[model samples]
Target: MSTVQDYASRLSDPGSRKMGTFSYLPPMSPQQIRKQIDWIVQNGWNPAIEHVEPQHAMHSYWYMWKLPMFGETDIDLVLAELEACHRANPGNHVRLIGYDNFSQSQGANMVIYRGRAV
Candidate 1:
């Protein structure tokens, strides 16, 4: 059977716009973050950190922090990098990127911190 359907546009959320999977959820605990980072490492994905001003976060490519931790297996080191990014850019949105080498593409990306004060 073939069917034609018409769709209507709906109003956007009144809540402030958000980006990334974790951004829409409650702030992730350190344990949760550790678990996610662990998965990134276990999957051999290169971890990278990025940040951008909240105003630009919705429409801009986040600025990379230093460089991607290529060939890094230590989860603690990744966490440390994230912490440093936060310390240095406390007023910007921070995210974690897991890049897959074999696929030569991003395997995972998540918002680790939303720096805008609520």
Candidate 2:
């Protein structure tokens, strides 16, 4: 088995990972996360949450958390749901998605939580 140092070394290698958008950004504070939710609401983007084991994070499909929050404008509500998802599936990689209804595709996708050290 690869030791933590080995895993860390691999992760440290440039181009070793090609994950979601937020994965590139520094971990967001709760306030920052709230702002992101607000941006989603302001743009009228449909919000959804999905999660998967860290090892399977590169897989295309992740288990959805309940359903998409359609027509949801309350940032607090979205934050609460994200918290619930993380609590329910502790140590799972969690992501937030913003689907564009007009384009019928995902407009924004980002990793909100990355689970590891299991």
Candidate 3:
């Protein structure tokens, strides 16, 4: 298994040719995209309690994928935490409709919340 330092070194090393940057690549191939999606799904999904607005919820999907270290179980725990925190928040009235990996209304590849439309 790769250590944290190893992963950090890989990310920070300028000389090493890595496929980490999204800037150089255009839209990924179907297989590559599928692998990315699978990885993200395996890590898990979690909503941000402080930013649970319609836009935030929709944007959460992209944000979740951007986080490099999280795993599927971590995501499940995070979503649970968000839900509990959101429910306990004294002033906010936002509700979590839960996460859907494949949102048909949005698109097959897009992950989204199945709640109020933003």
Candidate 4:
């Protein structure tokens, strides 16, 4: 039988990576950012960039209202579209906003923006 340590090791092995996205609702505070980071770590999703490192490749912030109000249905597709949009735009970092999943869908469903922070 496998020991608890074995399972724990598997979960913590950064090599076991999962891709997920984040988008922030407007009016969010620093505390909210901490909460979000905690959620990500707890979920075992490893970000491509370190949270504290300057010039991280995939750091972002998203405003809720900027998201598309309707038309598109699938969250994944929306995320892909938003990512593509960001790729087209010039920027150092991108934050997905309004990428929400309402129906208990798993994984990332955030709408984000990509640009250099001022």
lDDT of 1 by residue, 1-118 (tens): 9896443322242126667566657888999999999999899999999998776776657899999999898989999999899999998878999999899998989988777743
Candidate order by decreasing lDDT: 1, 2, 4, 3
Off by over 4 Å in 1: 1-15
- Pairs that clash in candidate 3: 42-72, 43-71, 43-72, 44-72
lDDT of 2 by residue, 4-111 (tens): 433232444332454765765578898988888888879989999998887666668899999999999988888889889999998887888998888999988877
- Give one digit per residue, the lDDT tens place, for model 3 in 1-118: 8764333323233323222244234545545544544554553542222323333332334222223222344445544554454455423323222234355121122222222322
Q: Rate the local accuracy (lDDT) of all candidates.
A: 0.83, 0.81, 0.35, 0.36
| Pick by lDDT: 1 or 4, better one | 1
Q: What are the clash counts of all predictions, listed in order? A: 0, 0, 4, 12
By lDDT, the best candidate is 1
lDDT (Cα, 0-100) at 31 in candidate 4 = 55
Off by over 4 Å in 2: 1-18
For model 3 the local lDDT of residue 68 reads: 26
TM-score attained by model 2: 0.82
Error of 4 at 2 (Å): 53
